[model samples]
Target: MDSLKVKAYGKINIGLDVMAKREDGYHEVRMVMQTVRIHDNIKVDKASSGDISITTNLGFIPTDKKNLVYKAAKLLMDEFAINCGVSIDLQKHIPVSAGMGGGSSDAAAILYAMNKLFKLGLSKKELMERGALIGADVPFCLMKGTALAEGIGENVTRIAPMPECCILIAKPGFSVSTKHVYEKLRLNEIQSHPDIDGIIDAIEEEDIYEMSSLMGNVLESVTVKEHPVIEDIKMAMIDNGALNSIMSGSGPSVFGIFDEPEEAEFAMNAIREMKLAKQIFLTEPHNVE
Candidate 1:
């Protein structure tokens, strides 16, 4: 294939737990990572220019080395010694810096597309291994389903897909840096951690209520402390018929799971009226099945 187009699906953290700071400087994290229906559309094709080029609908995003998409292409080109350049066109839907793993998802899509475009013949496991070099979250994005991520998120184990349900995602106008949240996190201050093992069991049984109720993020204390609006959005979602709501990742973005589709739509409408979320989406969990 000379070119490829794919949907770079975003993710939400069903439960995030921080263990301790490692000597390498990355935190030991245990989290249930979920792929959502929300995504960014990416199209990649070979170019004659002999340099990586990126174009995106969002102007504020960087187009150079700093961009994960560019980095992914560059990594493959150099590692494989591909002589041709690459052009990437991105139609971004996932909120940037919202803890949805948008950038990582895009990078994973590129890695998969480039492998096919160049016929590199790498397996999914090999691609995921390469993904870790780009970013911790990239491997999980490449995996794309329900899984438990530990060890800075590179160690992924796919669990059964999350219980089927309607999901409502809300992102306040502002974004938070994951680094900032991590830096501010004090493990000593945490009262309790989410029941990750129970969450996995809930997912296996397709028990949405048990799973949603168990969903939590340790970073919430940091992000919500900095921005109370996140909490407000969560409450709004729950008040409007969502079964449960929790912040996603090191987030400014919050997601609420609904047992009924009508409830989700209703929550979306009410959330829109409240004007708490800068960007609101009604979606569902995206599983490989």
Candidate 2:
């Protein structure tokens, strides 16, 4: 194929816990990541000039080397001694820097597509290894679906898909720096950590309620303290009939899982009325086949 199109799905962290600061200056974390239906569309085509170029619907995203997609293409070309270039057109629907893994997913999609376009015949493991060099979340984005992520988020173990449920995601009109969140984290002062194993079991059992109740993120303490609006969004979701709600990943974006679509829609409408979320999406868990 000379060109390919792929969907880069977003993710939500059902649970996140900071274990310890690694010697490499990265924090060890344990988290359950689940892909959602929300995604960005990426189209990659071979270019003859051997010059990487990227275009996105969003103006703020960099089209140059600063963009992760460009980095992914360059990594592939340089590593494999390929003489071709690629043109990446990103139609972004996922919120940027809202803890949804938008950029990482896009990067992963490019790697996957480029491998096919160039017929590189790279194994999934090889692609994942390459992705790790780009970003911690890139490997998981390539894997997609549900998984247990640890070791600065690069080490991933595929797990059972999350139970059937409607997910309502909300992102406030601000961004949180993952670096800032981790820097501000005091692992020693953590009051409680999420029941990571329990949530895993709940997913295997297909118990949506149990899984929802177990949802937690230790980073919430740091992010919510800085921006009280995160807490407000959680409360709004719960008040509107969410089984449980928690901030996904670092900050700002919060998600509520509901057993019924009607309940999720109700919660979405209520949250919309409150104007707590700059962007709200009603979606569901996406399991990669």
Candidate 3:
């Protein structure tokens, strides 16, 4: 194929555990990553121009090298010794910096599309290796389903299916700086957190209650303090019939897992009525083929 359009799906952390900061300035994290049905669209077509071109609906996303999509195209071209340039048109639906892995997914989609479009014959392992250089979550996006990610997020092991349910995602107008959240983490001050092993057991047993109870993100402590609206959204979701609500990834965008579709829709309506978030998404777990 000369050109391709790919869907870059968003992700949620079913459970995230920060082991410790590595000496290399990245946190060693163990997280259960699950892809959602919501996604951003990426269109890649060969261009006459010799330079990569990018356009996005999201004003916050840069069109230059700072954007992960740009970086991915550049990386792939240089690595493969290809001279062709492509124009990337992004219809961004995923909120930026909301811990949804939007950027990472976009980059991964580009790599996957390019490999097929250009007949690069790259293996999935090679694609993941390149994705690791793009971002911590990029590698996981390559598989786009449930997996246990570890070791600064490069290591990925496909796990059992997460509960089949609906998710109500609320993203306030403000964006949380990931670096600031990590900086504010008082490593020693964190109290008893969720048991990751127990979470895995719950997943194995398909116990939503046990899984919800252990759903914790230490970064929530940092971001909720900076943005109280996150806490309010969490409470509103739970009150509106969410089985469990917690901020996804870093902050601002909190998600409530609902056992029933009606409950998720109700929580989405509650978030809309409260005007707590600028964007609200009701999505289900992606059942990857």
lDDT of 2 at 227: 95
The root-mean-square deviation over C-alpha atoms between each candidate and the true structure, in angstroms, is 0.7, 0.8, 1.2
lDDT, residue 98, candidate 3: 92
On a 0 to 1 TM-score scale, where does candidate 1 land against the true structure? Answer: 0.99
Residue 233 local lDDT, model 1: 93
Model 3, position 149, has a per-residue lDDT of 89
How many backbone collisions does model 3 have? 0
Q: List where candidate 3 sits over 4 angstroms from the true fold.
A: none
Measured by TM-score, how close is model 3 to the native structure?
0.97
Give one digit per residue, the lDDT tens place, for model 1 in 23-67: 977899999999999999999989988899999999999999999
- All models: lDDT? 0.94, 0.93, 0.87
lDDT of 3 by residue, 162-245 (tens): 888888999999888888888788767777565777878898899988888888877787888889999999999999898888
Q: How do the predictions measure up, each by TM-score? A: 0.99, 0.99, 0.97
Instruction: After the best TM-score superposition of candidate 3, give how far the Cα of residue 261 lies from its true spot, in angstroms.
Output: 1.3
